[model samples]
Target: GPGAPAWAYAARRHWAALSPPLTGWMGHADPFAFAPEWQPAPGVRRLLVGTPPILAMTALAAGVASFDGIDIAAAEAKSAALVSVFAALVAARCPGVGVDAPPQPRHGAQLVVRHPHGRRVMAALIECGVIGDFRPPDRMRFGFPALYTRFVDLWDAVDVLAGVIDTGAWQDARFDRLGKVS
Candidate 1:
């Protein structure tokens, strides 16, 4: 971390001191301390190339086609798939779960899945033994990561919601009082 900060400082200083030697300013291209004016080579790229490892030293080097460090694209794809699968499952199992994908144009808050009905739906899920959260206005976000969650869990959650909605449990008197934040 210190090294990173020092590198940034040095970069700033290097750019600051890039003027011609006739400007009479020290340009050491270093961050530790400033030095007396030194002329930089004209037409020099001044590029600090990161040292190359080229490839990992493992014997399977030839077949290493992937760079999986922080694979956000893959993560996002998997997340989308999970959400889709869960939403489908909820739709199939609990036909009355009401996704709020109504005829009206969806607000950003709707995209967030936070609505009064969203909270009720979440509470209904919880009452029937499924864990979930509700955002403000109206949103119901569920995470069902592949290689992590089972499809049966989605089914079970839907079943629970269906039961709650069927019983009108979300409309019960116990849920009448809104929370302070609500």
Candidate 2:
């Protein structure tokens, strides 16, 4: 997650017709030749805009490599299941908290919940090591990426959230002050 790469895909037939929004030396066919005009490199190389960040790319490569032999479908199912379990737990234990997503199979890999004091609640949760972010108005998002998140983590997070809400721990004045970045 720290070094995730941004990638784009185009069909082979459309490669010749496509034009890169940004043109940089790395995308040139022969960057060292000092050519008079731009000559795009063959295939997807033409889409590269700048010199690659070697360290970031290396990390990205390793991150991608870690997925080798993993079943993506199974991962998706596990993510959905984890989200479902989390939502159910929140409903049962955390009164006044409501999920803001569609049912399973329609929802993505995260759970967004709404609460009157969502921002402060999220801050308290973060303090308890259950990291989640709050969106404006009244939304808090918790991500459960199946590759890294385990089922026990979901239970722990929901438990912390319930404790924060039940004991009025989120009422701490420190949690009310908003950060520059939400």
Task: Output the number of the TM-score-best candidate.
Answer: 2
Stretches of candidate 2 above 4 Å error? Answer: 1-5, 9-22, 29-32, 36-45
The Cα local distance difference test for each model comes to 0.51, 0.87
In candidate 1, where is summed lDDT lowest over 10 consecutive residues?
1-10
Worst 10 residues of 2 by lDDT: 1-10
C-alpha lDDT of residue 93 in model 2: 86
Give Cα distance to truth, residue 143, candidate 2, Å. 0.6
lDDT string for model 1 (1-182, tens) is 21121112234446644544222222234423445544343322223322323343242354343433647676556555556656566666665454544332222211123335667767666655666667666676655554456657767776777777677788876665444433
Please report the candidate that would top lDDT against the real structure.
Answer: 2
The local distance difference test score of model 2 is: 0.87
